[model samples]
Target: MTADRLQPVLAGVMLALVGFASSFAVVLAGLQAVGATSEQAASGLLALLIAQAVGVIWLSRRHRIPLVLAWSTPGAALLVSSGAVEGGWRAAVGAFLVVGALILLTALWPRLGDLIAAIPTPIAQAMLAGVLLSICVEPVRVLLDRPFLVAPILVVWVVLLRVAPKLAVPGAFVATLVVITGYLVDHGAPDLSLAPQVVWTEPTLNWQAVVGLAVPLYVVTMASQNVPGVAVLATFGYRVPWRESMTVTGLGTAAGAMAGGHAVNLAAITAAMAASPESHPDRDRRWIAAYTSGWAYLVLAAVSTALVGVVSAAPHGLVEVVAGLALLGTLGGALKGATESETGREAAVVTFVVAASGVAFGGVGAAFWALLAGLVVHGVLKLGRPSAPRM
Candidate 1:
C-alpha cells in the first residue's frame, strides 16, 4: 500500500491502542461496581468492543466520514459512582436497555433530542464532573494503601505525560502488566481459559435503577460522547449522519446490554485524532483511519478475556492505579467545563459536593440527584434576577 493508505492504517491502530488501553480498566470497574461478576464484566468488555468495531466500520464506510464510536467512559464513571441499584446487576442491564431505547427515541423524535441538547451545558458538565471525582481519586487512595506496589505505575505515567501525552495511560498500563507478571512469578499463574466466552443476563427493570442509572447514563453518554463527536467531526468539515449514528449506537447498546455491556456511543476524544489532518491531508480519505480502527477493535476483542483474567489475578484491584491515571485527564477537562462559567458556579459546586458525597435516597443514585439539585439551585438563583431588558 502507498504511504497515503498506510498512514491511516497506522493511525487507526494507534487510536484503538490508546482508546482500549487507556479505558478498559474503567469499563471493567464500572461493570463490576453495578454487580457484574468477572465473567460478566469480561463479557461486557467483549460486547462493547464488538459493538464499537461494528459501528465504526459500518458508519465510516457508509458515510465516507471518519465516524468512530466508543464505550461510554463518562457513563462508566457514573456507573462506578452509582454502584448497584435495588435489583442489582439485572436491573442495571435493564437500565442499559432503556438508555438505548432513549437514544433511539431521540433519533425518531427530534424534539426529544432537542430537549437533551437544551439542557444547559454547564449543568450537564457539572454533574458529570461531580460523578467523575470519586473515580479520579482512586490512584491516590491506592497509593496510600500500598505505596510501593502502585508507585511504579504512576512513575511510568508521569514520565510519559511529558514525553508522549497520548501514550501516557498505555505506558502506565504496561507498568501494571509488569507488576502483574512479578506477582504471578512469585505465586504461580492462575488457570485461564483461552476459549471464547459470553455471558448473557436477562434484563429485569426496576424503577429505581431506571431513575438512578438509566437516566444518568443516557444523559452522560449523550452530553459527553455523542454531542462532542458531532462537534469534533464538524470541526474537520464533516457532517455526521445524526439519525443513522444514533440508530446504530442505540441498537448496539441495546443488543450488548443483554450480555452486560452498559452503553456504546459516538467517540469524542479520539474522534478528532482520526479525522484531523494528522490522519491524512486529504479529507476524503480520512475515513480509512476509522475503518481500520474497527478491525483493530475486533482483534482486541479476541484477547479481552485473557487480559481480564490477568488483571483479576492481580492483588487489591491493582488496575485501579492505571484506571485512575487514565481518568485524571478526563476529570481535569470535566472540572474545567463545569466551573468555567461564572453564572453556574454555585450550582456546579452544589452538584459536585452532592455527587462526591455518594449519597442516595429511595434507592436512587447520587448522579441523578446531583443533576436535579444543580438544576433546582440554578433555577432558584435565576428566579428574581433581572432579565436582559428587551435585548
Candidate 2:
C-alpha cells in the first residue's frame, strides 16, 4: 500500500487507542456507580466497543464521510454522579434502552432533536460541569491520602500534557496500570479470570430510572456529543447525515443496552483528528480513517475483560484516579462553555452548584433538577429584562 493509504489506517488505529484508553476507566466507573457488577461492567465495555465499531463502519462507508462514533463520555459521567438508581442494575439497563428509544424518536421527529438543541448552551454545559465535579476531584482527594499511588499518575499526565497533549490521559492511564500492577504483585495476585464475557440482563423500566437516569442521559448525550460531532465535521467540510447518523447510533445503543452499555453516539472531540488533512490530503479519501477505526475498535475489544479484572482488583479509590484524570479535560471544556456567556452566568452558576451538590429530590437525580433550576432562573431573568426593539 502507498503512504497515503497506510497513513489513514495508522491514524485510525491511534484514534481508537487514544479514545478507548483515555476513557474506558470512566466507562467502568460509571457502570459500577449505576449498580453493575464488575463482570457486567466489563460486558458493557465490550458491547459499547462493538456498537461503536458497527456505527462507525456503517455510517462512514454508507455516507462516504469520515464518521466516527463514540460511547457518550458525558453521559457516563452523569451516571457516575447519579449513582445507583431505583431497582438497581436492571433498572439502569432499562434506562439505557429508554435512551436508545429517545434517540430513535429524535431521528424520526426532527422537532424532538431541535428541542434538545434549544436547551441553553450554558445550562447544558453547567449541568455537565456539575456532574463532573465529583469525579474531577479524585486526584486531589487521593493525592493527600495516597500520594504514592496518585502522584505518579499526575506526574505522567503533566509530562505528557506538555510533550504530547493528546496523549495525556492515556499516559496517565498507563501510569495507573503500572501502579496497580506493582501493588498487585507485592500483595499477591488474586484468582481471577481475565476473559471478558457478555452478560445480558433483562431490563425493567421504572419512573425513577427513566426520569433520573434515562432523561438526563439522553440530554447530556445529545447536547454534548452529537451536537459537537456535527459541528466538528462541518468545520472539516463534511456534512454528517443527521437522520442516518441518529438512526445508526440509536439502534446501536439499543442493541448494546442488554449487555449493559450506556449510550453510543457521534464522536466530537476526537472527530477532528480522524477527519483532518492529517489523515489524508484528499478530502474524499479520509473516510478510510473512520472505516479503519471500526476494525481497530474490534481489536481493542478483545482486552476489555482483562482490563476490568485488573482495575476491579486494584485498591479502592486507586483505579478511580485514572477515571477522574480522564475527565479533567472535559471538565475544563464544560466549565468554559458554562461560564462564557454573561447573560446566562447566574443561571449556569445555579445549575452547576445544584449539580455539584449531588442532591436528589423525589427520586430524580441532580442533573434533572439542575436543568429545571437553570431554566427557571433563565426564564425569570428574561422576563424582568428589556427586549431589543424590532428594527
What is the TM-score of each predicted model, taking all chains together? Answer: 0.98, 0.98
lDDT of 2: 0.93
Error (Å) of candidate 1 at residue 163 is: 0.6
Q: How well is each residue in 26-111 modelled by candidate 1, as lDDT tens digits?
A: 99999999999989999999999999999999999999999999999999989998998999899999999999999999788878
Lowest summed lDDT across 10 adjacent residues in model 1 is found at 316-325
